[model samples]
Target: MPGSPPNAPCSMRASICALTCWCSDDTRPIRSATPRSSMRSGRARSSRPRPRSPRKNGSPRPGPHASRPRASRSTARTGPGRSKSGSPAGPCGSIRSSPPRSGPRNGRAGDCQSPARGYPRGMSAPVAVALEPCSTGENPLWHAGENALYWTDIPAGKLFRFDPADGIYRKVYEGEPVGGFTVQADGSLLLFRVSDFARFDPATGSLSILRTFRDEGMQRFNDVMADPEGRVFAGTIGTDDRGGGLYRVDTDGTVTRLFRGTRVSNGMGFTPDLRRMYWTDSTAKTISVFEYDRATGSLANPAIVHAAGPADGTPDGMVVDAEGNLWSARWDGHAILKIAPDGTVLERHAFPVAKVSALCFAGPDLDQFYVTTAGGGRPESQPLDGALFHLATGTRGPDRFRSRILL
Candidate 1:
């Protein structure tokens, strides 16, 4: 009675009394004596007949068939009584919908779902080997002199090297988180930790800090590389309230800030002539080029070279081939894109895992492409998510320039 309409008269309310009952027990039938069409029309009066008025003593007169209880109407309705689309409502008054039988359903395009683990469309399956599952693996450097490969597990604070000839994997160093590093001219390693720059001597197994950052509010260094003249160009992230900046560290250990306002500074590379520099910002989803001055380690006239769409993934680590084509590792797009100098995509290589962290040219001829991945936050079900992968692309590139630091 409380939820019933308030404006109706007693006779009308009595005639519609059965409709007021809530179907609390779904197993029981809904008590409705009114005709289906009349109930659908929501009208109170019936066209068949009108019962006699109550007697003067206040007792209602008996109808012709009052003794028998009326059969309840079916809960299901059709025609005009149905929903606007002519479909019956669900039990909770909501329209039922089904999932699509085929095609992309999550706003992603059809191409994003790659077919195989190592092979993308139009490409053969590259050989992928699990050197070691790492939390965050980066900076794959192939030492031609030693005929071995070296890489870092960032969060694990460990350095690893693998020898293909003997098939032996060894841990060479254990220290702070190494963001990036460069091979020195003297066969040592120039390491850039989160807040400091250091040099590690593999011959003697010793690490010496060259420079330490004193800015407590600045985030750790994200990427680093040495120029042909031995100048270290590095970038740092910022605190919650500020953006990061790029810096240059000279051979004499003097640091100079070059540019600011970068949210997530990442991979960087220089052209063969050392005139144009390419830098990527993963958060901005853009790869920008600048007129570089190798003499002063300075950058100017910044312009975007490539910007990824929402589904194209963020550009992570990158490298420049001998022909000047840029190979970029896609962070979440599950593919790598090779772009020409004019910003045209020349090739695309897809992977089964979604997080492709970094790539570089390896092997004696620099014809092998080595890839690194991140397993820090990935689910355990992803088998190849954080392993190293490589492929012979039949292309050559210059070797990694040695760092000439005065140690």
Candidate 2:
């Protein structure tokens, strides 16, 4: 834990475990392992090699995705097209992959590499979206109620809706930099816009300010989710790297502060039965879980779910599949990570772009995944910088969490 810093990629094996950073395709493994602590100071001590399962042909397992050719890390392009500068357009916008990052997730790590690589072996591939670049695309939610997808652009103050049924996407609303939101049981939407909880009506195209935390004026809403009982929860982030917190908004228009001291609150999701909750703190590079009392609507027994180093990229938005695995968007890591309930990373799906913001399951069976990314957290000046991405993970996700419109 001491060696792992709070903002760098974990060492090589750690990166493999915690980040599952394959060179090109998510299915392929790295050709060789690197020494830990060589890339940076305060790195973790070396550990024994992990036991890999036998390959299909009974040959010694080749490196990850041995079927594919490796790409130059400097090239930076992973998907279909590349820019003149060699940086592929991220799913969100024109963000180029910077030099490889070095930092710890949650400021720590110890013997967590093997299981972190991916459990039960199959990696999910994310399809890069082809859309105009956005300023800072973050949270994405699938509206099963309307059979549409909704997402927000934090910097652009824009909200988007995509109808996969017809392959048409529209910019439905623009607000004061919304960070995250959830749908209610009554078909209204709850959002964390600016410094408070607000309601948005898709039918009338109007927004109503419902609750505020002025003390957190500098903080904006980031990640949001809902419980099975229809309780809404969202995370907030302070501008300029200050701090962030998590809050809960009930059906009766009550806002409750649940947790604080988080740095860049990111992904969040509830367990299948709604008895547990999980969330991410991006800057901290850690995902934490809590036990929820369904009847009382209270959280207890907090625990660490997963923590990634800077190399693994920061965790952003997340969604839970019917199998109970958490698929998270990785910012700066160029991958979408799937982790088992026991904190073991099940798979790492490479994204052509370096940023993966949020993901949701769409389609009639909830099997298709629609992910949103940004262009390196900046305005897009390049081609295909911020595009809507699609992936067929062949897994079904939970039901859509719709907000109960008080209006």
Per-candidate TM equals: 0.67, 0.68
RMSD of each: 24.9, 14.4
Cα displacement (Å) at residue 197, model 2: 2.7
How would you encode candidate 1's per-residue C-alpha lDDT over 1-407 as one tens digit per residue?
A: 01112111111111111111111122221111232342455566767786578899998777777797764422111121112254533222211111111211222222122222233232222333332556777878777777667777788776766554433345567767887888887888888887888888654567878888745446778677888898888877777434676788888888888877766778888888889999988778889999999888789999998998787788988899898888888888777788888788766676656778888777666766677877643355255556566554446677877777665
**Quality of model 2 by C-alpha lDDT:** 0.62
Candidate 2 lDDT trough over 10 residues, lowest sum: 9-18
Residue-level lDDT tens digits of model 2 in 81-181: 32225543333222222111221111112211122232222223333333535667767777877877778778877777655443334456665777878
Q: Candidate 2: list runs displaced more than 4 Å.
A: 1-125, 216-218, 239-242, 376-382, 405-407
Best by lDDT: 1
